[model samples]
Target: MNEAIKSVKLADMPDYELVKSGTGGCAGCPSPMGLRIVGKALGPNSIMVMTPSCAVASIGVMPKSCYDVPVLNVCFASAGASAAGVSMSLDAQLKSGELTGEKPTVFTWVGDGGTYDIGFQGISAAAERNDDFIHFCYNNEAYSNTGVQRSGATPKYATTTTTPAGKSAQKKNVPLLMLEQRVAYVATASLAYPQDFYRKVMKAKSIKGFKYIELHAPCGPGWKFASSDTVTLGRLAVKSGAWLLWEGEHGKLTLNTPTKPLAEGKMPLTELEDYLKAQGRFSHVMKSPQKDAVIDEMKAEIRREMDFMLGREKL
Candidate 1:
């Protein structure tokens, strides 16, 4: 584990007892760790709205819950709406003097599958209304809980059960989608940068309307990477410019970290190729020339996408 990640012992974490032994999160799941850090940053008086993705499963079902704070398990497509509803209900209660506690922070925790696909409509509605809540998408790049299937968020050339070895399309730009919604806050964080991730979560909590955070979470089983390599892969993703941290607030854009312009130099294709090839998912692509061509085309698409995002006039 990285020193930063390792430094956060469970004892040092708030609500740590909630995640004690017998919790439903995967034995070594990074999702809970990310959530724990986020929950801590958000503080104890928050309500988490989880959908029918790994988050719901990991946190366990009600009556046998794992988290110390209040949690609402809604359907996969209703995370954002549920959060909005909860926020409204809380406001109503406060107005009626029916609730006597501090204002509660509402957070919607969804997977890439939920946010990038099925839950988009609800998310859009919430953002359109400028709902008061923090929406988090722990993007592992695919439908990891449903057996590593391809999702709208899955990158091109990445192998998933649905995409196979020769994926035909590029990954969906989800953060850009949120930016287009003109949400009050939109930021990207990675597990590799725990402090940054924690700070962003805290910042989002302090903000008032439709805050969206897309967290780059790596899945050991889905990515075919070693359990110990999660942070490494996350770092490599940022280093390659495949996943740059940035924020869009009220129509202005600011990159969280300085990114080398693609015009200056291209990402090392060989390094990316080796990283992909080492994974069992991309094994077939490594053996076939046609598949290699597809991978190259995908890389070009990524370059094009990045150029557009970074406001480059020409590729």
Candidate 2:
């Protein structure tokens, strides 16, 4: 990143709106905040690639797109491959003298269903090849656009349409998976930390290979929270250690501000109990006979998953 970008503060954010209002998203959804940040950071010299996710609704039905720049809405599982193709196509255009300006950045904004399940194959392939693109996974933890069905990202014991009792599996940590793919950059993001996400996007833009950001998208309707409390709820997720904020650059991981404390034992993972209770999806678990036991189990599982990354960061 340039010196000017390095010196950028929250107060210095761009006032120009890339993503306009009148989105088809749920009332109080935090998805637009992240989308707008990406738009502001990449400026006009960028193209967004997406699949059939909630974000499609947010951007609008086309002929009336909320996205100011160009967008390529690909098939369900082709986000990774399509962005790679777009990047290469732009490069070819530049090299062939058909386009004079700098090659525009191509990014994929997919939901958890697209990232962790349906599109995992294409995404994995892109990461393996180190394709050039910025990939943001809007992880609401379920197939939220398809009526809140269970997704691979759904947390253990979280109730969903398919998992009425509760999901019986742990959430897949895709950032870590991307790290394993040896991508150029990887980060965990939350709507609560707009500046943090903004900085990460800037850093990713300066790089030339696959970069991934997993956005902890807390859906108001899906997660059963009031729309206005979206950011506050997102902060609680990070504060409680249910979500950790961190960046991985060139395959090296470093836990960021709030999460660094939680991972280092300054705060307890049990704080996640409160975070869990705040969500309606986890209501079944909270009301179960063994609520404390359930929470304890979840804490242990999260700690185990996080340890793989945190331990490496310490080293």
Candidate 3:
């Protein structure tokens, strides 16, 4: 975990050491690394409402848990609702003088499949009510636990079990959807940039009401990339503009960083191709001309989205 943190440009602090060997995380899973970082940022005085995703499986059963903080593993569709309940209960306790000291920060941690699909309605209800909790979606881009199936958050032209390379539908814009709710804080982070991610997580901890962070967590087994390439893929995803890192408070929008300029000899599309080509999941796309066109179109869409978000005239 220390090595992974260092690789991702994050500090190797003692606080972020909850996930040790023997945990249920895969041999090299980015989700656990993300959990460790997020937990460290949120500190020990937080209550996590994890859903039926890799997070629950990774943390393992009861007595031998990977997380240092209190974890409430709930049903897949109840993450947001459960976290809201925790927040409400905490508030009630504080009001009744039944609890003293600082109130614990509540968090709902779910995967892309859980958040963008199965748990959408619960999340929407919570967000609409301006629930006081941090809702984090650690998107690996698919239903990884269920064998690399396509989820609403899956990228366009990506090859999942359900959506082959030839699939025509585009990925859902989840952050934008949450932004439309006019929540307090909405941002995007990736495992590759941990300092940035940690900062956002810490910022969310300090804020009140529906704080949502969409964290990009790479999967070695599902994405068919080597574990070592997780950070590389993360960087490439942002550089390609496929994953925009921005924050929206109320109705305002701010691009955290300018997209890597294509005119400045930075060919994110080529880099993205190189990154994807290394993965077996996208191997078939490389061999087919039609799939290559789809990939190009996806890249174009990414560029367009970045341009729109950054308020730029063109890519």
Candidate 4:
């Protein structure tokens, strides 16, 4: 893992004052908090391209918007394209001297449904072109906005409305896909590490060309967990080595946060059972007759993932 310089104190960062509190997000919905953190990191000159996602349903609704920064709501598949257009238009204005002062940073905020499935084409095209913008995917592991349906981001053994028997497929490795695009920056962040998340957002803002960050956003209602357990689940996920935190800059990968220690074997892996039992979505996984097999499968996957991150083998 490449070393990362220590980040600045949170108080020293800019206050964009964009995302407001008391939004329509459900209790423990991490979307609003994630948006707020990104907004503050980007400061005042920022334009967000939104899509048909839980975040949009919560904060980008018509007649009343909770964001202080400009948000353009597009179709589910158009977030990347829309943001690219905005970035080009802003660049044109800046070049023509029509837009003075600092130029607005273009960003697209979407959920896993929009990112891993519906909007993948547009996003892939934008990444290939090295578009000047940031793409943030707040993944809660399902189509959380539309009744907790299964999505490409859904983890194996997690039951959703469409996958009540537990999903047979593995979750999409989105960050690795972005890295394959050879973009300027790619990272994974968890709300449990607020400062780490904030630091990545700030780092992305400073870079040029395409940037992608996937945030591990825990959904309270969708996952059937206590609202207060949102942060706890996030922490456990990292400690358990189920979710790895890392950053890729200019094609170089560096493990970050709790993942670094786990991958390096400096820290013992937290019990996967502890993390799985805490979420109601995985209740079936624990009670199923094949529970032992399912648990072993999950454990194998984690080991393979950790080995890949530590450069022992490809995942």
**TM-score of each candidate structure, all chains considered together:** 0.86, 0.95, 0.89, 0.95
List candidate 3 segments past 4 Å from native. Answer: 1-9, 12-16, 164-166, 258-270, 312-315
Question: Model 2, range 1-315, lDDT digits (tens) per residue?
Answer: 233546256678887677787788887676677888888788888899999888886677648988887989999889999999999998889899999977898899999999999999999999888898999998988888889999999888888989989888777788888876778989898888888888888888988989999989898888888888788888888887788898877667788877887777776544787788777998988888998898888788768756765788865
How many pairs of residues collide in each model?
0, 0, 0, 0
Which run of 10 residues does model 3 get worst, by summed lDDT?
1-10
Order of quality (lDDT): 4, 2, 3, 1
lDDT of each: 0.75, 0.84, 0.78, 0.87
Residue 163 in candidate 3 has what lDDT? Answer: 77
Which prediction has more favorable TM-score, 1 or 2? 2
lDDT by residue (tens digit), candidate 1, 1-315:
012333344345555332444566554466776787887787778888888777677665557777878888888788878999999999999999999878899998899999999998999899989999999999988888878898888876677888765466867887887887778888888888777787677677777889999998878788787777777777777765667777777556666553434323543423456556546666777777686676676567657766666672121
Model 1 RMSD, rounded to 1 decimal: 4.7
Error of 4 at 114 (Å): 0.3
Model 3, 228-263: lDDT tens per residue?
888888887777666777777764666665344542
Which of the numbered candidates is closest to the native, going by highest lDDT?
Answer: 4
Higher-lDDT candidate of 1 and 3:
3
Q: What is the lDDT of residue 13 in candidate 1?
A: 52
